[model samples]
Target chain A: MCHRSRKTSRIRPAAGAETSKTIAKERLKLMIEAEKQKLDDDTLNQIRHEIGSVITKYVDIEPENIEVRVTLKDYKKRA
Target chain B: MGKVITFTSGKGGVGKTTTTANVGAGLSLLDKKVVLVDTDIGLRNLDVIMGLENRILYNLVDVLTGKCRLKQALIRDRRYQNLWIIPSSCSKDTTPVLKEEQMKRLLGDLRKEFDYVLIDSPAGIDYGFSLATSDADLVAVVTTPQVAAIHDADCVLQILKKKKKDIRLIVNNFHRQMVKDGDMLDIPDICELLDAELLGVILEDENIIICQNHGEPVMGKHTVSEECYRNIAGRIAGQEIPIPDYIRRKSIFSRIFFKNTAGKLV
Candidate 1:
């Protein structure tokens, strides 16, 4: 017979704050989404520069001031 | 013909080599002729982990470059008569010595000779990885529950999917206590996140390290890790053994009612 310890097993976390596992899951989901997009810094920078240049031709915007962010829409619903 | 399977992890230190060794051993224990190939080139660990380091005279580079015959490069395991290993070259230079065509030809030759040819792929999604997965009939991507490891696994999975390879996921170093305490990611969540067929989950067992330190695989023993490996090997061998639920979080009612009984209620 296998003997188990008498320690109490807490399956649910205390009310209010999120558990570390939840946080890790959310972070991993976002990270994997970003990784799947395969958008490197160089590509993002190029996008930023190209966008900034196109905007400067029409409006007064600096290339350094242009920020390109990649976010996955509906990533939470992803299987 | 034998099936060529490559064990790879995009991130380093995720038990790719250990999994290759133990799974190869487990398959051999099932009376299948299995051969493990270390494809890490400059950073080979399968030889050391399988305890055939001292016997490795001709490595994979030698066999591919015509420096030695395939039989001469293969090192038969002392414990498992049907299991053999072809270690990688340990030269200081990290230049890739084996090309993709060469690796494919070598794997083709291996498939004709063995029932299962397991290749331990080096970490990263570089040339070495391409060479390892070039001719693989199946690819097993090993990863831990960490964010970085899972992210890298997803990256590798995307690449393998583009290549249209049959891919599976293996979760390693799973800490049940931490997962129970809501401190670590559970197996099901990981499987969903990676979006790959679950192969197996190896519990975080120190015996794995201890056995690898002794240049032996953690198989055939009655340890939890051994059972996990055997189940994985069974699945690989087309056995329908159900994967044991390592994270069966006990409900409050069951915890209250079966508290006094043996801890098998969960």
Candidate 2:
């Protein structure tokens, strides 16, 4: 697994707006590197509860009453 | 255009003929026009399974050989007006009957007239199977939960993918009692093991064999097996009908041993 800190450190801009385009391209490459998955309903429901409970413990929310929904990432290829 | 779907299994006696007959019948029951073609040439079974054996005046060979029109060759189902069967003949060797081109032409012509042209493919991944599935828009790979059947299904799935044919898995002969006893593989287990999208599952029902012996289409027969075929046909027609849960029944062993959950106060 790639840590967010490590990924950010490597893909950070070269200290100026001159390299903004390069950073954007680098980030696009990083985004494409993550795995895409098709999850079933049972797994998705379990994930919602586990993640919701952990987040509710950290934030101002009730774990039992929390609601969580997921959406697939939609994208189109460039010609 | 009518969709051409082939019901196939690399292993024989896995209910491919039965699935084709009932799924076609179920689709016709839903008012969709269907003509089932038995591509298992020499050992034709669909006509007999659907009980249209005596009605076959001209088989698929007659049409392909330019002896009859496609419409003239099809035997209309007695039970459903919308369903028909283009049966294969057992009177002669079927080895040279179907060339891939001829099969394509036949399906192309049939596609113009019906809502669905379902083919019962011959068992194995040989010449008969290749010709049968040549023009299929979708292939329903039928299989039982047995180890050998699933292994053969996996082989068929691999070959279908290699040809880039649209494929879906149909697990047949699922037994509720056997499944509950942990003696049978369930739908999810087979699908995962085969790594193919499941179209439907047929339970091991006595009604299917009863209907077959009586020369009747088993779908819409007020059994779980009937519902299974209907749901499969619905999905094939692009209706998203969820797979019906197997009707739960208490196992004989369970009923005998665990009849009383309440402990005795003695």
User: lDDT per model, in order?
Assistant: 0.79, 0.76
Report DockQ per prediction, comma-separated: 0.01, 0.00
Model 2 over residues B165-230: C-alpha lDDT tens digits? 988888899888888788888665776688777788787776666556556776645665777888
Q: In model 1, how large is the Cα lDDT of residue B188?
A: 66
iRMSD, per candidate, in listed order: 13.2, 30.5
Chain A TM-score, cand. 2: 0.39
Candidate 1, superposed: residue stretches over 4 Å from native:
A1-79, B250-266
The list of candidate 2 runs beyond 4 A from truth reads: A1-79, B247-266
Among the numbered candidates, top TM-score falls to 1
What is model 2's DockQ versus the real complex?
0.00
Per-model TM-score versus the true fold: 0.72, 0.70
